[model samples]
Target: MTNALVIGASGGIGTALAAALEGQGRAVTRLSRADGLDLRDPDATGRALDALDGPFERILLATGILAPSGRSPEKSLARIDAAAMAEVLAVNTIGTALVLRALPRLLARDGAGKVGVLTARVGSIGDNRLGGWHAYRASKAAANMLIRGAAIELARSHKGVTCVALHPGTVATDFTAGYPAHAKHGPEQAARALLDVLDGLGPDESGGFFDYAGRPVPW
Candidate 1:
C-alpha cells in the first residue's frame, strides 16, 4: 500500500494535497500543530516523527510563512525587522532543515520517493526584477538551498529519491488573504497542479526548483 505524508496538514494547500493523495488511493498521514508537530519547536518535531512509521513514497513539507503575524511583507530594506525575519527563517528554512534530518528514515529507499518543500517563485535570485519582502524571499531562497543540499546527499544513498523545492504560486488561503495577486489558484487546483509537477520529476531533476507547471525556476 502506498503511503504519503503531509507535515502542514491543517493549512489550505496541505489539506488539499493530502486529500488529493488519499483520493488517489494513498494512505495519507497528516501532521500539524494539532498533532504536536510544531516546526518552531525542534523537540516537538522530532517527537512527532518518532511516533510515525514510514518510508512514505510521497512527503510534502508544506509549512511556510510570508511573515510573522501583525506584520506585512517588507516593502524596503529599511522595513526589515530582526525579530520578524528570525521568525520567518525559523518556520521556512531552519525548521525545514530539521524536518529533512529525518529523511533517511521517512523516505523510501527501494523505490521512487518524492519530497516537495513548498517555496515560492519570488525566492528565485535570478528571476528577481521587483524586489521587496526581504525576509520572505531570503527565507525561501535559503530553504531552496537546503533542499538542493539534501537532494544531493540523499542521491548518494537513497535510490530513486527526488527531493526538490516547489513553487505553488499564489493560492487562495489565509496565507495570501490580504496579499493581492493578479492571479491566484484555489487550494484544490494548486494541489492537483503541484502533484502533477511532482509526479513528473525524477532523480535527474531532484535538486532543481520548479513551479507548479513543472518548469524549472531560476535559483
Candidate 2:
C-alpha cells in the first residue's frame, strides 16, 4: 500500500489532501494537534513519525494560520503586533521546519516518492509588491527556503526523495475569509490542483516551487 503522512490534517487543505490521497488508494496517516502530534514540538513530531510502521510514499505539510478575530491582514506595518507576528512565524515557518527535521527518515528515497509543503504566493520575494502581512509573508518565504534547502540536501543524500514547495492559491477557508471574495478558490479545487502537481512531480522538478495550477512560482 502507498503510505502517506499529512501534517495539520485537521485543516481545510490538509483534510482535503488526505481525502484525495485516500481516494487514490493510499493509506494515509493524519497528524494534528488533536491527535497529539503537534509539529511545533519536534520531539512529539519525531515520535509520531516513528510510530508509523513503514516509510511514507508521500508527506504533505499543509498547516497555516491567518488573521484571527478582530485582527486584519490589512494592518499597516506600524500597526503590527510583535506577539501576533511571532505566532505566525512559529506556526508557518518554525513548525514546518521542525516537522521536516524530525521526519526525514519517513521520506522515501531514490526518486520514487514526494514531500510537499504548502507555501503561499505572498512568500515569493519577487512577487510581493503589496506587502501588508509582514509576518505571514516572511514566515512563508522562510518555508520556501527550508523546502529548497531540504530538497538540495535530500537530492544528494536521499536520491529517491522529491521535495517541492506548493502554493495552493487563496482557498476559501477560515484563513482566507477576511480577504475579498474574488481571491478565494474552493478547498476541493485547491486539493485537486495540489494532487495534480504531486502526480506530475519528478526528481528533476524537485526543489522547485509551483502554484496551484502547477505553474512555476517565483521564489
TM-score of each: 0.98, 0.92
Estimate, for each residue in 100-134, the C-alpha lDDT of model 2 and write its tens digit.
77546777554377888999999999998888878
User: Which candidate has the top score in lDDT?
Assistant: 1
- lDDT, candidate 1, 1-219, per-residue tens: 799999999999999999999988999999998999878888998999898899799999999888998889999999999999999999998899999999989987777899999999999999999999999999999999999999999998896999999999899998899967557989999999999999999999999999999999999
Residue 46 of model 2: what lDDT? 67
Clash pairs for candidate 2: 109-160, 110-159, 110-160, 111-160
Clashes of each: 0, 4
Residue 38 lDDT in candidate 1 = 79
Question: Ten consecutive residues with minimal summed lDDT in candidate 1?
Answer: 174-183
| C-alpha positional error of residue 95 in candidate 2 after TM-score superposition, expressed in Å | 0.4
Clashing pairs in 1: none
